[model samples]
Target: MTWGRARCALLAIPIRPNIRGRAVMAYDDNNRGLLLALKYGDKMEGVSTMARWMARAGRDILTDTHIIVPVPLHRWRLLSRRYNQSAVLANRLAELTGRLAIPDLMVRVRAT
Candidate 1:
C-alpha cells in the first residue's frame, strides 16, 4: 500500500475470492456497521467486515509477500485520534490472512 499527500492505496494481486485484476484496498465509511452494546460501548463492526474483505482480497498477495505494510499517520494525528485506523485495519487483515503484520517497515515522514 502507498499513501501520498491526500491519497492512500493498496496493491492488490489477483487470487482467490477475486477474479478481477483489481480489488479494493481500503474501506470507506459507507461500507461499515455500527454495533452498540451496553457493556462494550459502541463497536465498529466494520472492522471485522473490512478485515474479512482484506483477507479475501489479498489472499494471493499474502502467500507471496513476507510482511504487511500499513501506512502510518503523523504523530500529531495519531495523538489526536489515539489510534492509526489504517494500522488497526491492517492488523485485522493480517490476522484474517494468517500473515505477519509489520507496521515498522514504513515510517511516517513528517513534513519538514
Candidate 2:
C-alpha cells in the first residue's frame, strides 16, 4: 500500500531534534516499549493512538507544518519486515492534522 510505501522502500530517516525543529514526539516516559511495539511488534493499531498523542504534543505548531514526512527504513530492514513504523506514523499524523505526508523531500545517500 501507499501508506508506508516510502518507508517500505527504504530511504531517508528523519530525526527530530527538538520541539522547535521539524518534528514533535509524544511522551518521554518509558517510550522504548511503544517504539518497539510500533517498530517490530506489528502494532499497526497504535498508529492512531500515536498520531493523536503526537498531534497533541505538536498542537502549537501543527499550523506551521505543511507536510508530515516519515523517517524511512533501510532497504534491507523493510525487505525483511515488510513495513515501516515511521511511515504510518507520519501518514496518520498528517491525516489527523489535515496536513500532507511528503515522503520524498529528504533523500538518503546511503542506508544507515
Candidate 3:
C-alpha cells in the first residue's frame, strides 16, 4: 500500500501508545505462500530472509528503535503451533540490527 493508504489504515486500527507501522511487502499472491508457510506451516527457514526484508523496509524506524517486541499469541494457539512466528521474526531482526528482542514483554490476557 502507498504511504497515504497505509497511514489511513493504521489510523483505523486501535493500537496502544500509537506507533508508526510499515509493511515489508504487500500480501499479494506472490508473497502469500511464503507468509502462510511461516505463519501456519511451521516453516521457519525463510524467517531470516523475511527479517532482513523487514529491517530494510523499516530502516527509518529501526534507527530510533530500542527494543523489538513481537505480538504474543494466545496460550492455546501457542500450544498448538509450538512457536510464535512473530517472535522468530523479531529475534532474527534483532540479530541483524543489534536491537534487543524481548519476546515476552507482552502478554496475551485473553484470546481474541
Best by TM-score: 3
lDDT (C-alpha) at residue 45 in model 3: 89
- In candidate 3, stretches whose alpha carbon ends up further than 4 angstroms from where it belongs are 1-18
The number of clashing residue pairs in model 3 is 0
Q: Could you tell me which 10 consecutive residues in candidate 1 have the lowest summed lDDT?
A: 32-41
Off by over 4 Å in 2: 1-29
Q: lDDT by residue for model 2 over 91-111, one digit each (tens)? A: 888888899997655555467
Tens-place lDDT per residue, model 1, 6-110, is 232264443222122225543346433232121133344577786787677766666676566677877876675566667777788878777788776567879
In candidate 3 the C-alpha lDDT for residue 20 amounts to 62
- Give all candidates' CA lDDT scores: 0.59, 0.73, 0.87
Point out the worst 10-residue segment of candidate 3 by lDDT: 1-10
> For residues 1-112, what per-residue lDDT tens digits would candidate 3 score against the true structure?
2344443233585333435668999999999999999999999889999999999999999998878989999999999889999999999999999999989877797887
* Root-mean-square deviation of Cα positions for candidate 2 versus the true structure, in angstroms: 8.9
Q: Candidate 2 at 69: error in angstroms?
A: 0.8
